[model samples]
Target: MHPDGFAADLARKPDVLGRLADTLRAGNPWAPVVPPGIGRVVLIGMGSSAYAGGVAAARMRAQGLVATSELASSPLLPAWGPDTLVVATSATGGSVETLDALRRLPAGLTTVALTNTADSAVTESCGAVVELAAERENGGVACRSYQHTLALLIALELHLAGQDITSLVASIEMAAEASAHLLDTETTWRPQAADLLLGPSGMHLAAPAHRFCSAQQGALMVREGPRRSAVGCETGDWSHVDVYLTKTTDYRLLVFAGSPWEAQMEEWTTLRGSTVVGVGGTVPGAQFEVRYPGDDADDVRLLAEVLVPELIAARAWQEQF
Candidate 1:
């Protein structure tokens, strides 16, 4: 992986997130593209875009909107008519699967593309467009675009629900601040990376939404920088498959501090002599802790939390170079 390109992508997060906060404050950025009379919402995309859709689907479901997520590659679309809304996200607006999914939808169905580029393939296919105002990532990892897409999806959901996002904007600004601070102190993570990089790394989060977004990004960034195997799963699910691998292999775990299952996983892995590194708050008996400055580990906090793994990846690149 190119070290300078990796760092450049990580550096763009603060500005990108800050811009999103500003856009939220200026009223709904996605208002023009908000689908009319959406009964069921299906979000589809690939990679980080798919994970971002999963995050949005969770929040939309919580708001009593019938929402679900599917990978654009294999969208097991249920039978639904024109009222069904399909929102596809592709950072570059050029993902073939996403465009294909959009095309395969019922002709009368309302489809929107949440993408970084307008007039791209996805935009040409969808009925409406919500463009993300983000710079192109120099690195292959979709760092800033993932964060920007998350903010836009959250904004879109709030607009569709006809709810004010004042509190959400505040949380976002706080998250941006946390991201800036993390970038400043990114070097502090090097030793931790050195200690943890001796083996394969896995990331597990407590909640499904956070797990989907953070863990997927973690694995992607890890592969981009360290060129190592990084697996992502929910906390409880880890015990079923990943735990067995950890016990027998030289595996390290990156447990996002949230859930009771996290503590159990830490203990289980520690007992097996696997190094566990905590991402957010302290995990009991973690080999190292990367404390992020937020009480709530909501989707907004993810803007800040993603920085840690990128730093680890950067360290790996540095070590190799």
Candidate 2:
């Protein structure tokens, strides 16, 4: 890998988020309370930022808000109204599709933007901005921006739900440390990812983040890194549909779990003879576990779990380009 690679930038996640913690101490950006009578919230972004929108949508739904996430490129953008809250998130705030979606919102509709870059397009298109208190993404993979965006979205959700976030806010440092620990201990995970003999790989996520979108970044990493074919599917959906077509021994599987189907998927994959690594949650009989090293309520899992796939890409693809 090059000295100035994505891996180098990823190593600095702890500092990026620690600064975010300090920024939060001063004040939260999503303040003064979410207005009453909000009908629904639509979170729009492209790629990884769109996935962050998914996490925020799930958090908002748990808080009893009617929320949904859509791609900025979706032709069927949700109908906008006075009561709708439209949020556009882009790491650079410069994605043409996301900026265009924000521009098309009703003039009086409430719109918010979460971004790392200031004076980018979305800032002008939206009514409010919660600029991430983090640096621009390096290595072209957006490792820091992706993690910081998720943190910012979770903070917004906590404030909107009127919950005390003192404890949640304090866990940021712990999360970074825990992430570092995971990376340090799992030293072989990255090298194994470059194995020439490894077969096609698959990724499944059990979360509000849809499978394809959740795995989108990881798939890109593997493609750009090891230059291999990788596929993604929702956890249960994969268990039911794709499981039948594959010989268990034909593929290696990685499951990012935060749902109840963990054990079932583990047993199924084990029966099929595929190796599995569980992150964020465990799967019985799996070969390895990249445990989410914090309490269940800790939002750091969202930030930390992606490091596994990222490291793989960095090791395999870093010097190729």
- Determine which window of 10 residues in candidate 1 has minimal summed lDDT: 200-209
Tell me, what's the RMSD of every candidate? 2.2, 3.1
TM-score of model number 1: 0.92
Each model's C-alpha lDDT? 0.75, 0.69
**CA lDDT for candidate 2:** 0.69
TM-scores of the candidates are 0.92, 0.87
Minimum summed lDDT over a 10-residue window in model 2 is located at 203-212
Q: Model 1: runs farther than 4 Å from truth?
A: 197-210, 295-297
What is candidate 2's CA lDDT for residue 242? 60
Q: Give the local distance difference test score of model 1.
A: 0.75
lDDT of 1 by residue, 1-321 (tens): 367787887877777777777877988866776656878888889998987788788888888888888999885876578788788899889998888887778778888888887789998998888878777777666777888888777887788788878877877888887787777876686576556744644433333334457777777777767677777777767777677776567777776667567766766776888777777777766788777567355654566677777777776776787
List pairs with backbone clashes in candidate 2.
Answer: 248-272
lDDT score, residue 222, model 1? 76
